[model samples]
Target: MDKLRTVSDTKRNFYQYHNRPINSIYRRVVEELMVEMHLLSVNVDFRSDPIYYLGVCQSFTQFMNGYTPESDKDSIFRALCQSIDNNPDEYRGKAETMLNFASQKSPQELINWLLSPTDDNGLQDVANHWRYALENPKFKYSRLFAIGLYSFLAKSDAEIVKNEEKFAELITPLTDKLSLPIDKFKKDLELYRSNIEKMTQMLTVLADTLEASKKKRQNN
Candidate 1:
């Protein structure tokens, strides 16, 4: 296959694999992240609270830093431990226990569990959660929450490139079309892309912070 065909095929295959649910029904990570943001909206004004939003970004990046396709049960558990360790004030008590339990699973399994709804409540799935979060009157700032969640996911994608093993795993598959001599160029490009992604994430946060602050001032 040509390079373009290879890229398309790879994406299609991976999407089919990653998007497939271990459970009978499929639940997307993006939807789950939005639901999580809605829950967070109860405590922080993603639209108005600059500091809280920055904290959200920090938390998102930290969590994503620990997670990747290459992540194992132990690494994920350690990441959860570190998060709880660093933010005892936020992640303590019953919440901490639940998170600790959740961390033992692989990333896919963990996501599946997160996207799964309670059996007793019949809460539906991740899509239902996202819809409820957006439509519920209690989540007045849900639009903002969703926007923040999208940013969090984007940042997480960029953060994953920082993982050398994960990055190599990601790029190695694309090498079928290239000559051996171009390997150095591919490596260079990987490093370049990683740096650019990180810088772009930083700029996005700064830009979003400024825009949010401007809107808040105007509303005041």
Candidate 2:
């Protein structure tokens, strides 16, 4: 938080994450950040509060990013599909960045980015990547980022609706993919009425276990 103290609102509001296909979701997240923090992000041009992050900042790097005209994109798409099917987590971000970027663009901008000439042997997976995201655990469990991912998914006719079975299926596979023990995610979501309630429950369990151990040690 201290890092925030030295900065002006303009800089913070205008902070751009320009590394495309890597920080693809940055534009949307930054936009949301500006909206959420709008009370502090003020401007005087119209004597009204500045709407920060209302738009994505697409750079002039269009021609240099993707595959050349002659390169075959077949193998990358196959690999992405296989990796996602065998285990979704392992391929979490393989094609998500451009999907996020394309999703957030306006129609004209979208057309421009799509039609831009390829720089070199661009991975054809660019065409199939979002389709992969549509089929993975990332599509279901990544609700927090669905808005960012949704831009692509929406265009692809993908759905990320709230569903209980999907939620359950998503958490378990995702937990294993990340090598997280299933019990941990379950434990984190527990709610108690108060801190004291949680403390009491923990103390009671700890005391009973400790007492049983004391008896065992004494008997031994």
Candidate 3:
């Protein structure tokens, strides 16, 4: 805790002269803190909430040397989503930044963010509403309804969702399998977890390919 505070304070002091030398001592401080966070994993279950999402937005903005465009809110939003999907621990420090400059994200954005980390089982907190909005979608946030539901379904139980449009053909039979009701959420979390794992694998493969290409080019 003291280390984090020391880094935070160091950044504050460095901000005064950082423009003159531009070494950005604070950047190193923040990165060290991020490493500490990776080791800690303090907030293991950060229940996909508005505050958490907004915090991620703030963290990116702050790390970019303290300038965020008014017009590029969507870009910032997407980056935040991607970062959270990448590292949940780094997101804890994000809360401070988010509290200052971030806006509350749309429900659909929230849902999609959760769904995109499909392989990370930590994100299943929002599953109950996945199909509810897909079928009904009455409110202003309805625009998010379909996309969120589809993302969730694709990562969870694609078969049920693929045929969900045929409410009679699919949802009816599913209503019996779980023995609860057709609409009640089934715990097919493996779908989301597998998706996240797949993404991690793909990223690893791409990174390896890029590194190999760089080495070959250097050798040439």
Tens digit per residue, CA lDDT, model 2, 94-190: 3344545545644334333333422223424443443343334332221122222223333433342134344345334434443434443333222
True lDDT of residue 66, candidate 3: 27
lDDT of 3 by residue, 37-71 (tens): 23222233223332323323333343333222334
List candidate 2 segments past 4 Å from native: 1-32, 35-97, 100-146, 149-157, 160-162, 167-172, 175-220
Please, what is the whole-model Cα lDDT of each candidate in the order they appear?
0.37, 0.32, 0.36
* TM-scores, each model vs. reference: 0.22, 0.22, 0.25
Error of 2 at 200 (Å): 46
Per-candidate clashes come to 0, 6, 4
Evaluated at residue 61, the lDDT of candidate 1 is 43
Task: Give the runs in model 3 whose Cα sits over 4 Å from its true position.
Answer: 1-74, 78-184
Superior candidate under lDDT, 1 versus 2:
1
